[model samples]
Target: MAASHPLLAVRGLQAGYGRAQVLFDIGFEVHPGQVVTLLGRNGMGRSTTIKCLFGMLPVLGGHVEVRGRPVNGHASHRIAREGLSLVPEGRQIFTDLSVEENLVATARRPRTDDGRAPWTLERVYALWPRLKERRHNLGWQLSGGEQQMLAIGRALMTNPTLLVLDEATEGLAPVIRDEIWRTLATLKQEGLAQIVIDKNVKRLLPLADRHYVLEKGRVVWQGDSAALHAQPAIVQQYLGV
Candidate 1:
């Protein structure tokens, strides 16, 4: 892929379940080494958009491009092979699998041309050492925080060029949330592009390179951290903060 090209580009995306339309011409782009956030109040189509991106839900219309390749109607696994990985909502780890099993379940090597250090079990463990300690524990045996860490490590094990995280720090202890944020910061330093969704706008402001605020399934506002930080009312109005 060209260095100047976006890692992922979503343009005029339209998707929903069966007969219930949710997203309305949604659009966003994530570039190499950038952290872009999807901010919205609950049920405003944030998670729905993520599902569409990962090919978990078919798009009703429009397109999603990964590494500049159109993947609108591709299967989820096929999308994963195209250098995108997701830490989906609810940290859906395999209940019967051990922590090591979960990490290696969907692991993959990077493309030769990817030109980045491929993520290995060791690297992921280094990022989240608690996972190393619980390597033999089953997914269900871990606490929520530990499960979330495993979810992230599993995604990293895929060696994705772009990682998408839904609700990056929801339903966690404050300390755990801080740990997650710090890991994200470390990933940022390592130049891993990410698409993140979370309620912690305060934590995201410094971590994110750009912000897209959604409402009624539409992008109501978008700007960089400085702009978003300057406009507190935007958060109050759109995010109900």
Candidate 2:
């Protein structure tokens, strides 16, 4: 079980690619077992924020702490070892590797001190049985949905403390999208902390505990589902209807 503090916290985060800054004063929190969403249209700073959080980009200012340990400017591999796992915007799976190999590549023992069980191939297969059926297929051979599932399973194999998804659902059939949402709900029930970025408000609203809406690389609004539901104007103004 998580302590009484946030699992991941970012305050006044600033980062970019060298001279061109894309994020400004970005901030958010994801407590243990909490589901948080970063919402915005394309070209916003959502993906940039994820990169900075995962140490893919350098932090220009502010603080980023995971479980009270400051990880600002840490190396990406170091950050991963510290328990932040990212499913990047593109499903960057190893195209040549088979499903089982991809999952086993990053597998690790859960670093949790609590009695929670660590994720294993058997558990991942249980979550997405389709992956088990396609265990021998190369990454490029799977459909978009199967690839997404593999990406997610590979992350779980890392036994991360916080799961950050850049684009939770972008391109997929309706059935696949629904399965992804259900998988997310199951992860939430299993006490996994998650930070999701996706455009499906109706689906996200119910699943997320809180939301941060960004525009022009800054967080414009932050609130819970009920608060967001109470203000449609904010959604239409910052995010499209």
The clash count of every prediction, one per candidate, is: 0, 0
lDDT of each: 0.91, 0.89
Relative to the unseen true structure, what is the C-alpha lDDT of residue 118 in candidate 2, on a scale of 0 to 100?
88
Q: Write the per-residue lDDT of candidate 1 for residues 1-241, one digit (tens) a residue.
A: 1267788999999988889999999999999889999999999999999999888898999899987889988999999998889998999999899999999999999854556778999998888899999999999999999999999999999998888999968899999999999999988888889999999899999999999998989999999999999999999999874
| Runs off by more than 4 Å, candidate 2 | 1-3
TM-score of 2: 0.96
For model 1, the superposed segments whose C-alpha errors exceed 4 Å read 1-3, 113-115
Give per-model TM-scores: 0.96, 0.96
For candidate 1, the per-residue lDDT at 18 reads: 87
Which pairs, if any, clash in model 2?
Answer: none
Cα lDDT of model 2 overall?
A: 0.89
